[model samples]
Target: MRVELDEERRAQLPPTWQRAFDWAEESLGGRVVAWEAQPRWRPACFFELEREGEILPLYWRGARGEWHRNTRPLEREMHVIEVFERNGISVPTRFGLCEDPPGLILSRIPGRFSLDTATDEAHRRKVLDEYLAQLARIHSIPIEEFEAIGYRRPESPEQSCLGETRGFERSYRATKTRPDPMIEFQLGWCHRNVPKDRPELSFVVCDAGQFMFDDEGLTGLLDFELAYIGDYAADLAALRTRDLTEPIGQLGDAMRRYSELSGREIDFGVIDYHTIRFALINPLSVAGMVTDPLPQANYVQYLAWYVCYGRVGLELMAASTAVELDPPSLPEERPSRRSVAHVHLTELLDPAQAGDDGERAYQLDRMQRTAVYLDRADRYGEALESDDLDDVATLLGRRPSTWQEADAALEELVLSSSPERDPEFIRYFHRRLSREEALLYPVLREQQGIAVPPLE
Candidate 1:
């Protein structure tokens, strides 16, 4: 019999009952006394509790359901930790996986997760050097164990670099609710310029520069979702993404140290190739959020991040291809049109008023994000829309009143056209994204860039 809870039945429900918390209870073999969501970009559910006599700090290793990222298989991540743990890397000791809620319960590694708290400037520099050493160590791990565990192996050197793209390509096809011209442009460009010359593959964590530390030093290496056997240079190149939030070290200095540690000559061209690949593929992670939002998901916050960093990625991608960047091409700002409700809502956003430290942190996070959008509006407003419509007219030979129409028209043009298959596609998409990025510069975080000369 189908029994739906009415008002009377709902009143009878347990006060402490939550589906996620219930899973945690069963996983821990005790009732969860307290829990809090971890503040991170990725989906994670973290908590601390007592089981019998001992307090256990645990993280639910994977999301509940329906994530669109092209990540390596989750089961592989569990095995990955085991592989590294044997070699004496500092990873969380796994307790066990919950069969129902579907995540690994990891015994938390103790210490501060951020490196910013390290007051000693000398240790900070030493820590960066240690990061490169760790990367070398990870890459040095023999691939035979990974192979034994059925980690996907590439057929050739080209496949080694390009194979990682398959996950994102598959995901974009399945999760994209609308046409994305820029993402299509990147996909097409990648097809045209897959790297042919590459050295031997190694066990590379494609997303490098992620780990936690305490006063003692590198305590816990974290987030290996993109691990695979690929060009080791791609791992070195991926640190550029890390530099956006928390920098590891200077790229050239790290390269030199890496070469010393591994006794392999550094190839800037190969590094640049992987860098361009990073630039092209990164936007797909948040493309769905920007185009069409899912209910209760913070699409607005992610959209701000995408717009800010997506521009930098485009600039670097274009620069890698030796395309000339145009000067700042900004749109005109419109008159103040802040509504009554908008002003009152902005006034009410107070981080201090939040009930707890976590809530305060989250409140501050959204405040900064809200500032980015407000900055975007202050700088460009509806004039940006006009620019997009003009671009659409040029590309499709028809004017579009809204970006949804423009985006669809461009995707139609891109899908049918040979621009994607030809090398000239680089120049074409470069022109589009670079200009768009320029418009968004006002809202972006101030760049503390360490310059590296173009590849030979």
Candidate 2:
């Protein structure tokens, strides 16, 4: 049982990272005996160490490269975890940081990743209650404690509610390759509707509701890459998004549990606002990746995430503002001349061709999915573009002939519009986003049913 990597996955990591396991072994004064990379967009691995006749299961959590907008340095993450552990928050014991590849080494916490694997409904409720209690403890941590560690304290009520939202918007604008009216609308709407009376702030795991759990209860809260100082409602808003994928127990009941544990009144309005803001993150963080992907980039994952979460943001906006939206009717896909080529490409790149090489198979699966998306586009692309331009024409008082022209005109309108126009903008973007959703429906059907769970 020696640490090793298959040729395909090994080539994907940076040259410097090839020795990351050895570095972790040396750091811990142990021998690396076994390791396997976690199959996700980011680079991370689980490995076991042998030290002084005992074996320790450890994890090396890697950074999401500089390209990612919503990530922190590995050192900062280590410090954050240390603070959380000091404050009695359930977290893995940090071993040290790997400087070469930029990751953290820690004792592996044992548990399943989500509540979706609970033995039964009773088990799910019990684990969820325990998780909500942990969330309350997290929100209750003293602001000064985190402030002492260099987490910025919000100076005003606006900063308390809108600070993270502003940061996300800046990231989106800086990295986006093209005009995105949907993102623009969300930014404008959030800025205009910032909860002015927000007086409370806490150290929030900005990407909250991510933790590991066992039959007994939560093993540890994981992933602090996006932690920040902000309104606690932001964390609750994150749980709503997580509920879409992880099936967290009912949010309304969870809110009651959080309110009881934290001894603070829950503000449904603030949570609603944050839900809209929170949903923007999925699309924004992956915008740069989708537009200019790296060789190892999980292109289809980012594309599905953008289409699915972008639509979720708009739907949340509609519900919050009482806007009723009608899904656009798609014209039957007329197969384009290149349609047969797409079918051929999917067959050529099928994941089954990769055989037992897990990494190769994963990459092929993504390639095949890309072909499927393109096939859908070939069949329906023209009709969808026509629908989009028509919607833009309705908003801007003139039709734009091309997708680029439509995006430019619609984004211009979004920037200059007032909050009073939010309903119309939400409706327009909702219909527009639904088309993308429909195109990627085969690969991402589960995400389509995601609705913002009621807070009250």
lDDT: which candidate is best? Answer: 2
Clash total of candidate 1: 0
Task: Kindly list the per-residue Cα lDDT of model 2 for residues 14-125, writing each as its tens digit.
Answer: 5655578668767788776667656567767788778999988988887784323333466777888888888888988999977666678888999997788998999888
Give the per-residue lDDT digits (tens) of candidate 1, residues 417-441: 8743333434445455555555444
Off by over 4 Å in 2: 1-17, 65-72
TM-score of 2: 0.93
Error of 1 at 415 (Å): 4.8
lDDT for position 259 in model 1: 92
Model 1 segments beyond 4 Å from truth?
1-25, 28-36, 41-46, 64-72, 113-117, 336-338, 357-379, 391-402, 412-456
